[model samples]
Target: MTRCLRRIAALALVLCPLAAAAPAAAQDSAAAEALFNRGLADMEAGRYETGCEAIAESHRIEPKLGALFTLAICESRSGRIAAAFTHFGEYLAQVDQLTPEQKSRQGERPKVARQEHDKLARLVPELSLALPPGAPAGTVVKRDGRVVDSAALGAGVPAEPGEHVVSTQAPGGPVWETRIQLAQGEKKRVELQVKDTSAPPAGGLSGRRAAMVVAGGVGAAGLVIGGITGALTLGKKSVVEEHCGSGIGVSDETACDQAGMDAADSASTTGLVSTIGFGVGLAGLGAAAVLYLTEPTQREPTAGATSRRIRAGVLAAGPQGVVLGASGVW
Candidate 1:
């Protein structure tokens, strides 16, 4: 009886933990299922980004085969070709592990995943980095701030279609950088070289200087507007005086007519506009002066420096106003 009781107690201990885990596992599965349904609904509603995120989370939680396939489709629709391709490959790789019945139930899905994987492989862009001859040893390369493996330096690596920043650094040498734009299925190569450190850094206008240029342009525009409106106000004043009084050099208030009232109103409107323009002109000028005077006299160039020239000026003047222009070379 004692031995039977001890065996019973040991079995109870193990069974207790399993029983406790059953409910938690059920709850997790229910949550994953709910997320999967919501993700499907979101994708159907054209919310691809949110749907992808939800489906991805569901896969992370439960890792169902259906969820994996759905995630690949969601990522593909969301324009994340690389992720879609990788997930599709993963799905295909795991298909053989499923039971025969499970494989039969997943009819045509494996075929579809294979087709998508191949299609995306062609759409993804590639980038290759090459070092100049006699480049120093231990040259490190980076793409979009992520370190690139030395073995990948000469080989074309897949990249998403967009702008990418590539930089290279050598031990005890200045860093060199470049920007490249890639389109779908495009291949690009960048040659890396050591930066010339002997010359002074060539960073164009500082931020404060750029702001000053904008403010100065605005001030110039306001002054021109005030001048034009002021002249119009004066012309309207002449008309008002001619029609409001009996005649020239006369001040008979009772002689004013509807035409004189209209002229006076016009003059007042133009005068207000002129005042506002002058106020803006003065404020903009003040801001520009403050920005310029408080600006630092010098600026340090960033790592992997590039030469830039920023030019801003009044490009053209016409009867209406002056056209301001700003251009930069990088």
Candidate 2:
């Protein structure tokens, strides 16, 4: 019994390392696979920051070609095209050991890399238009008093390296203006403030008095016509009632009929004239209100400026639309 006990003790001692190592190894493999999957999920969702973190963790645990390839893709999608190309090249250097299917997948990488490279090549010297918070979308962007493409609001737009005036305007707002200087391969952001000039000036009388006078005249004319029409209608009703009273019969109706016809014609003409006058008056009043409301409260043109630039070969954040950066001479 003592001999049997000694043998069992020895066996336990010998197997202890394998028993402990098995669980640790399994945990590490599982963690690595989980991180890798999360990285792919992030890349697919366009959450590049999370994707980068996950891919980096997966690479740290196990250096695999697939992980590196995914990392490259994540970098490219995150606007780090140069780094993506480098990592893709590194993946290709290890392509010899891959199976036929893996080689086929690997073969497609270069083509994708090349396309990204081309896109990057065309994406230098971008200009960014910074908009104030709550600025209306679809506002017109202008430069040097001329309209420029509003497409830059999406992302960075390629522009020549130089100084330029930038401005934006919307309906019922004052024009916003600023100046910025751009360097070769530099990405510059220009913030524009949209002004609101849709209020009338104070002091009860200024700038819009003439329009108001005209509108008042038109309104008064309408009221007078309406009053005249109402009076005429009342008179016609009285005359008709008098002539068509209880004792008047159809055979005794010649003068009554003539009087009734004249009254009817007068009432119809007055009603038509009143309606035209009222419609014209309402239109004039509306036009006057629009003119008064949209008049500029203050004529002073105020401007403020702030700018940021990113050179080519550098990564930068941009609002949606075109992506641009300055490139070094290749």
Best by lDDT: 1
Give all TM-scores, in the order shown. 0.50, 0.31
Residue range 178-244, candidate 2, lDDT tens digits: 6777665677665666855554534445446766667667757766776777677777777766665
Q: For residue 33, what is the lDDT in candidate 1?
A: 92
Residue 52, candidate 2: Cα error in Å is 1.4
What's model 2's overall lDDT?
Answer: 0.66
Write candidate 1's Cα lDDT for 1-330 as tens digits.
999999999999999999999999999999999999999999989899999999999999899889999999998998888678888989998998988999999989998998999999999887788877877788788888999998888788878788888887877666777777889999777666665345234575655667888888888888888889999999987787778766444568646577778878888887887877766666567667756655433222233556555554456543444455556664
Once fitted onto the true fold, the runs of candidate 2 whose alpha carbons sit more than 4 angstroms away are 1-16, 99-330
Candidate 2 TM-score versus the reference: 0.31
